[model samples]
Target: MPRHPTFTLRPLHAALCILLAGPAGAQTLPDVVVSANRQEQQSFDAPASIHAVGQDAIEAAGPRVNLSESLNRVPGITVLNRQNYAQDLQLSIRGSGARSPFGIRGARLIVDGIPATMPDGQGQASTISLPSAQRIEVLRGPLAQLYGNSAGGVVQVFTADGPERPELRMSVDAGPDGLSRYGLQAAGQSGAVNYVVDVSDFQTDGWRENSAAERQHLNAKLRWDASEQTRVTVVANVFDQPVSGDPVGLTRGQMEDDPRQAVANATLYHAGKDVAQRQLGLVLDHRLGADASVMARVYAGQRDLDNRLSIPLFVQTAPTASGGVVRLDRQYSGVGLRYSRRLPAGDGQVLFSLGLDHERMGEHRQGYINNLGVQGDLKRDEQDSVHSTGVYAQADWAINEDWSALAGLRANRVAFRVKDAFITGDNPDDSGTASFSATNPVLGITRHLSADTNLYANIGRGFETPTFTELAYRADGSGPNLGLGSASSTHAELGLKTRLTEQQRLDVALFNIASRNEIVVASSSGGRTVYANAGRTRRSGVEVTHSAQWTPEWRSLLALSTLKAQFAEAFTSSGGAVVAAGNRIPGILDRTLFAELAWQPRAWAGFTGALELVHRGSMVVNDLNEDRTDAVTLFNLRLGWQQTVGAWTLRETLRVDNLTDRAYVGSVIVNDGNKRYFEPAPGRQWGLGLTATYRF
Candidate 1:
């Protein structure tokens, strides 16, 4: 579980306002603050690439218990766990932007601000339940061009608002296949109104073999304050899952000799699968005074899925052949709207926004067979639709006191439609169409050489469009190639933020990205696979982070990342040789590393530990490199504890994954030549958890 990176919380809210303004009138650590560039500024004064993850370092890491695998260990991004719990999941951030086979395209997922993907980007998010979240922001390149047709970046989630007392929480967990989990939460306030609620449930018995799973979750929040410039907020969520579709793909020496036999579930296709989701949201924050303020939001969502497969006819010769069945169904809907404003020059601050979105999708299929008993039938239907509108504005100028600058622009208009029907042979029916419009831009710079140090630079541009199974999958008969366009990128970065004293702190970044057209999914004619628009690709990266508090009961954190992707021209297949140009752009993973350590000792006790390392390189499954795979490494561990008596409070955790049961293979798989690959990365697993809280 990874992919969910791009963070920025204004450096942990400037280190919690310098630990709550202590150290006698603290004044450094503040050149500009941020609300994700909607207003409030600083961070090289905004231009893009934001990243933040706090809430006490996400409760001291604890190997992130959900919430998209705790943002998939931050850093550029990559998260693909097609199996091993949480049924079928995938996410990518740089490479694999619009050629998704199943791995949500070009990222863009938000919570609180609503818009949980769904506009052909297809997003379910495993029913997000992060125990009252309070922080998680990641806005990549071009600041994601104000959330519209993302080209890979933007995952914002924020919950747990209005607090100063009243609280309650509970949790429990169990592990090792047959796992179990439960959770509950509550928040409070009265007079001016404020509230929060959450619930969760999870179960698993999977590791292949008819894969079993069960999940349920709900979240809610409300806030109101009629007087003093008015304010209103509301949010809701619901998710459910009941799955059992074991499509095991294994390789890597049979998963290093058995990762539960790499799942296939005793054949017969192993059927049964169901998934559901629902969401609702509303917001209005007014303060028509004090530098002006007005915010509005509306949202709606729904999703349903079903699958069943079974096949078996003449296996090991003909003993009177018999058996076959297939079924699938899917549906989705979405709506959204937004508006924002903020102005007050002088030291700097200016922001603006407008938005609208719509989405719809549907699919159906059926098949049957029973030889010896004689029976056969087949039917299929599909549909897709999407519409979008957007407008944006940004500014943050402070040409004094350490310089600052920022700029923004966004304009989008889109529409796409498709329909299809079939029944056996004789060219049943088909239909398709397409549309597009795009505009994205951004710029940035900041310098505040003192007060703890700061320096920044930025450049931006982004775009993406084309999904709905890449404009109606038709594969073998060609046709359905809607003059592909949209798929562009241009990004640059140079950064540094420091406080290297008083408990240490550091952040560094250097990035580069370039692209053009670049939308691939080859193999046409009879064998299927369409959607093209390739040529050009380049990516460069580096990130470093550090945190400290050596004494006072220890505290530590360290992170490192490096990446390189290439391919800038050269093509000719369809049996024509050629095909070359830097290569190596397949499942990106040059290196990654993470570390953690903690100890509180009093003030409610505390203890934490963690470690992670991964390096994946050497790809090329087909772009005509003739299959390739080699390069792997993995490790993980965690332990945690918390305490507090009186009103009640307790927490505990212990986890060990891989831990030496090594055997990896996770670089986003989807190359059905039948040699089956991708199935490793699960062994020697363990988990145990407990949590409780209360107050009034």
Candidate 2:
């Protein structure tokens, strides 16, 4: 199950004929609006595989950055930089998600419309804090099936509200390892009330060497208008952090010149890490009388984590170490309702949504003598409770004039409970457990030819359940287990959308997915732990994107994706054929490319210059093909400045990332016998920023 030889698409058709022979300039392009099928269209008439990241590209990408490195310059993303800022931050889209050990377990993270996943879906949303974002949409396969765990897709995030005028902003940044950042923002409007506020602070002394980091943040937004069809909104967020630890599974000459000396014989609780978070929200929007509209929302969140790890043993006479430390507390609550109507047939529309989610998790563990430590006086304690409910309906039929059709369906129900305590030999041991239900489904279609072309198709179903730390994880490490159930998925897609002129725009898709009883995590021989279903799996893909404006100040964007995953049957052990049936699926990557180019000139007054290119391919790090990874390319640069002084406005930016300082390894994790790895980029950096704003 290992093969290589099949490389020639004539350099991807000569890079798409030099990007379709550049320079057809001015074609007016700026309509980009999207809520991705939950309503709000015009992303060239959205049909799926959407992408957006406005707010001026997140202020030219800066300030306590690394939202997967600004989503890896978008385009069939696959960012994996476990450079550890308190570990766990690896992302994947298009190519069947989930690469565990914290951070995304079957993708789904929505903010603003809330649903940051966690109802035993193992949620941890990468400490999001993007300067109170104003946009960030990324929907891929399965068209996300209108949320509710549509298996790998959806990362909607939209913040920043309550401002129609009056504002103040501040930003400061410094880079190159000892990075520092500061930010502040304010907004105002009075009459029917409105306000927004933000604050940030960051510090780093990283790039290795005990790796240090500190963070603090606060965000708030509020709006009210009680008379014209009612409206109310409020949101608050807070975070605090401390981190110091890097060098995970090192080797490559210990990450070239001291990567904290490869954990320095481990200890310090095996490299300590800490985190804290909090959130609160409420939203209501009603206009229940003119064509109909209604919305409601509620949210609450909390999280705390501490970890210590260390392991390195080779007994016979010496060389020893042992580690384990964990402390976690998580709590979340949610409520939602949505309705929209405007139907009399023809130009018809109908939408409905309902949701409820609750979660409470607490776990504690201690067992150390190396691998970092702190969080003691506990041999294990656990408590978990989860509940979920969801309902949905959709329609947007316009069956005429280019035809259109969109249909949807959603259903979900999940429940779980667990309680445990232990302190063996010192007395005390107890347990309790439960599990309830799970279901999902969705569909879509669209067609238009002209007004810039279009065509689409979709099918969906998704689900995941099993948490309480994988049903009480324990493999001689003490206790917790009480049965488990829930894991399913099926997805399909087809697509094409075009604009091709007016500065170009294009999208293309073809997809397939399948899953069943696939829960994984196994090991045996004395220290044993298990949860296996591992049967049935398949994934297929193709994605393409292009954006151009070649003149009128020059602009360009390109994207490509291709994937293939398998394992429909066949599994053996005892050192042979561990996985068969068309192998290939383990951190899937067969090709990915992203390109960006920009130059705004006309006498450089409000200037801009940019260039970016990222490429990745060749991967297969497990399922017993020994292990492999190769193929990497990266480069980035940006320079900016803008102005408008009258109502006050100013901007500045400068960036450069890994211009060339490669020594790859982006992700890997092979249990028990260990085989870590993670660090594919970061080395060669530069940043500078400034911003100011005011209006009205």
Candidate 3:
């Protein structure tokens, strides 16, 4: 076994001292984020771990094409790019949603006040509209529990507001591995209406064989001021992924031979997926009185998907076998309303918000036999539906100039129902209904120290329900598992926020979480998926992030995280294999550091350059704690230039990633029973793009 490295911050402390010696001058701080409290307030006043990535950071290297570019710099968060379009990125916060096989779970995703996470705690970012996003806010610790179910943490994306003047922008990008993208956007305001529209198309021959993908996106947002007391906003978007190839995971032997090689089954069965989705949302804000208001939103969407798996032919011919071809047609809708009331008190004021949310999802699920690339006999059919509702009350009170408090309570209930549509010839009735509910609460306190420093602590209870995919099958040959219970946990945090200098700021935090009845993947065979409740987990960690403008033309940023997550009790796998306590959790790195430096010399106007370094520690691959991937470090370089002339502006950038051409595992499929666990990342790649804009 390899020796673990000792924990120390001496290296970072020394670096901070050097940065503090820069030219002393007055500079304004960036805009404070208010999403954490669901209201507009200075970040320093919030008693939580909150961070924001603004428009300048999002477009530093040009157009925002990938979410990882912004997320990897945030503390207490992990966003891994699998480079496989068939699967969404693996995202987790403080060991929350690491075990998910596909899509995002255990976290709330919000876009323009609309819930991207479905009623059953399943989510995907296929329609994020990154190119048109103005900012993203991440909320961690107790404050996140206010979102109800699946509240591991909160990630919210806000659309860019239209400019007062009409403007149009066009851009084209190209990179290695047959990567190409085109984008166009138009924004402006006309009298009482403000509008922004963006469209993009992308295609790539991926880093690995049989991993190519093609996609297109269209997004629009509009707001109208009907009167001084009432306003309405609309948001709509569509995503179409006509081609997304799956390369599948590689075994140890296969990776050793060639890291770029595709799994044999992937090419044999032509495994891949096709998806199309469209959604629309509307929001209204009305003032009832001087100290009261109402905000409400309604949204609806539809999604169609068909995927082909790589199951062996023999497995599908068995009598009690499920098929390898899956199809889903789903329709979903939701409504949310909130009432805000404020009252003046002694030397302070109190703000309270009462909210209600309701959502429903209906899906037509079918399975078919796979004969190479052709579909064969039917295997399973069912109508699956989920209905959920939540009621919540949140408040923020400022007792005086030196103290403040925030508290919230939420009650959530979700019902899952399945209607068996294929019950012929030995296929016994497989219909059932199950419900799960939880009551979550959060409390936080903030102590204002000096003028520019604060200390805070918070604690909360959170819960999560199984996704529809987790309840599709049972291991005891009894069809669907309807008795699965919800998972619950408690989270605690202590943090310090301070402004060290006019141009620098720092945040440090410590957190712990203990969970019970955690759900884990049990077993999978013949395309049937099953899950079971397992051992408890204890996770503790420390996170820090620092940002500074070292000099007039130089800037630096740093983020570091150290985490220890392990099982708290001995358990057994679904295959009857014993798993001991103290096993490190799979799918997360124990430690990570990200550092960046940028130089924009005044000598050369309109020119900027940056260098980034990233490091990730080794991580276990499965429950046995017998296999792990090696640690890896990478370097990236970026350069850009901007100029404005009369009525036109031009910008261009070049980016080089993985400059060392390192070979590493990007992510792991948690607890794969077949022992296939490794997913190799791209070696090296580069991209260059230019944007031209017109103002009228």
Candidate 4:
């Protein structure tokens, strides 16, 4: 196993000291409210680790291309841009989802109160529409368990509501490497209805060989007030990506030789993917009384995908090999209902909530041999389905002036079934079914030390089931690995929230987690991977966040996280490698930092500017720790101008990323048998954006 090294951040320390010593502004920060505990409450009073990113911050970040652009401002989370449009962003929280080769697992995703993650614990971040987002909320630590299975953490996006007056807006953005985006939006409110609609087109030429992509997006929201106590809302969205090139990862040697070159097979086989998706949802809120209410939601969606992989022709000839080409048509839907009531308790009040949710997904899956990018003979066919149901109850009580308590319990059941449709003399029927169930509980307490300080503690249990992708292959090149089991975890956290002055705030949290039967990659080759289990593992970490307003025109924010994650019991991997206890987990960095400074003087009228810094520590690529990537630091800058005349508003922005033009690896593929692990980051890039809005 590789030895963990100490990290130095002298520059960051100096910056912090300077910011802390600066003169304080007179403007006071406003209070924040959150729903992380299934109930509405002040963030400072909630006994959980939760953070919110405002719309202003999001708009100032960059071109609004991906979540990785701004998520770094939050502590205890990691989101990386792989520069491969065919694949989703690589995301993890506290080391839980680092092992995923594609898409997202071990974390939950929600949009407008609708679940974006499927019942099988798989999700894609591409469906989110950042242009229309009002705010984003993130929740981590023990309190996250209340969300049911695979609750390592939660990320939720909320769309903006319509304005009182009718408005139309148009935007254009251009960047290096022939990148461009065009967008249009309309929003308004009538007698009893509110509506918002948005559409966008994005295209980019190759930054590296064989890496180009194009996409179109549409999002809409409508709300109606039936009466004084009844409300209804409808949401619809569409996503289309006609094509996205796949530039496969490179070995260290290949990256050093030429970071801009694609692997030979990528071009030879024309590796890439095509995707389309459509979804619609409805939400209802009714008030039974001033202290009681009921909420219900229903949603349905469909997704179609076609992907081509660069597997050697010889490998596809094996009797049980699935193939090099993949196709999927999936239909999914879900419904949820919740009831809440508030009652007087002691000097304050208690809020009670109970809810039930059910979801299902069915897919037609097919695999075919690839004859130089063309589909050839059929190799496999199957029907797959997953069903999940959960029931939960919670109570938050403000027992007295200085004390509060929260308790919750949840039960979940998930079932998976697959039917074989193509069978041959050499391949026997591989149909199978698997089911998992668990009950989780969480408890928390908070103490108000003074008007400006609060301390809290919490503990909970979490569970996760293997996604169908993980069950598709076995280490020995057999069929689905039904023998794989679920993983469970115990989590605890202690935190502090304090207001240092009228314009500054600080948040700190410490957390620990222990898990059994942790899922891991046994081997990966030719775009396919097999799964196994490690007996036991541990993860502990500390996170710090600070924000300050100095002299009204100067403001700063900083977030830092340090973690220690490792295997706790010795185990022999299916790849014939002996993983010793205490080996550091692969694909997870031990430390990360993000800091920013902004200057927006009142005297400057319409001009604003900011500087940002991001740092990531070294990480191993495999269980044996034979190879790793170097730590890297990046700097970014942005400037903006806004003007209004008559009934029109105009805004423009200039941005630059990776200012130093440093070469580095942004992410890795863990346990890749072919030793193709590193994905190179882009060099210095620049962008320009302009938007115009007209109101009537």
User: How many steric overlaps are in each model, in order?
Assistant: 14, 11, 0, 0
Best by TM-score: 4
**Candidate 3 colliding pairs:** none
Which has the better lDDT: candidate 2, or candidate 4? 4
- The TM-scores, one per candidate, come to 0.32, 0.33, 0.97, 0.97
- Top-lDDT candidate index: 4
lDDT of 4 by residue, 192-291 (tens): 9999899999888767677788889999989999998999999999999997888888899898898877888887778888999999999999999999
The whole-model lDDT of each prediction reads: 0.60, 0.66, 0.84, 0.87
Model 2 spans with C-alpha error above 4 angstroms? 1-46, 49-70, 75-82, 90-102, 105-142, 146-206, 211-267, 272-378, 381-401, 410-430, 434-503, 506-546, 549-555, 558-595, 598-635, 638-696
lDDT of 1 by residue, 1-696 (tens): 122233333454465445333332222232323456654445434445566676555644432345445555566666656553433556666454523444367878778777677665555456666667787776666566667775477767778675668788888777787878788878888889888887878777766555677877888888888789988788888877765445455555565566555344224444445677777777777777765566767666666654443334442122211123334355554555445555657776655555555555554533344332234543334454566666666665665678677777877767776565542344445557677777787788778787776787878787777765565443344224466666778877887877766566667778888888777665421112356666778888877666666566556555556677776888664345666887765545554545455555556556655565444444445555555555554566767787789998887888776677644554444343444445444556787888888887
The true-versus-predicted C-alpha distance at residue 155 of model 2, in Å, is 9.0
**Cα displacement (Å) at residue 39, model 4:** 2.8
Error of 4 at 262 (Å): 1.5
User: Which candidate, 1 or 3, has the higher lDDT?
Assistant: 3
Candidate 3, poorest ten consecutive residues by summed lDDT:
1-10
lDDT of 4 at 547: 89
Residue 213 C-alpha lDDT in model 1: 77
lDDT, candidate 2, 1-696, per-residue tens = 113344444686788778877668475777678887777787777777788877777778666455666665566657576656666566667654533544666667777776666766655555666887887888876657556643477777777675777688888888877888788888877888888788888888776655566878887777888879988878787877766464455543454554434456443334646788888888888988887787888888887776565533221112111125556777777777778776666554444444333434343433333322444334455566667666767666666667677767667666666555444553345455566454565677778888888888888777766665566554333345555556677888888888778778778888888877665554321112244446777878788888888778888877888777766776763234477777766666777777788889988889998888777776665555456567777678889898998988888889987687555566654232344433445556888888777776
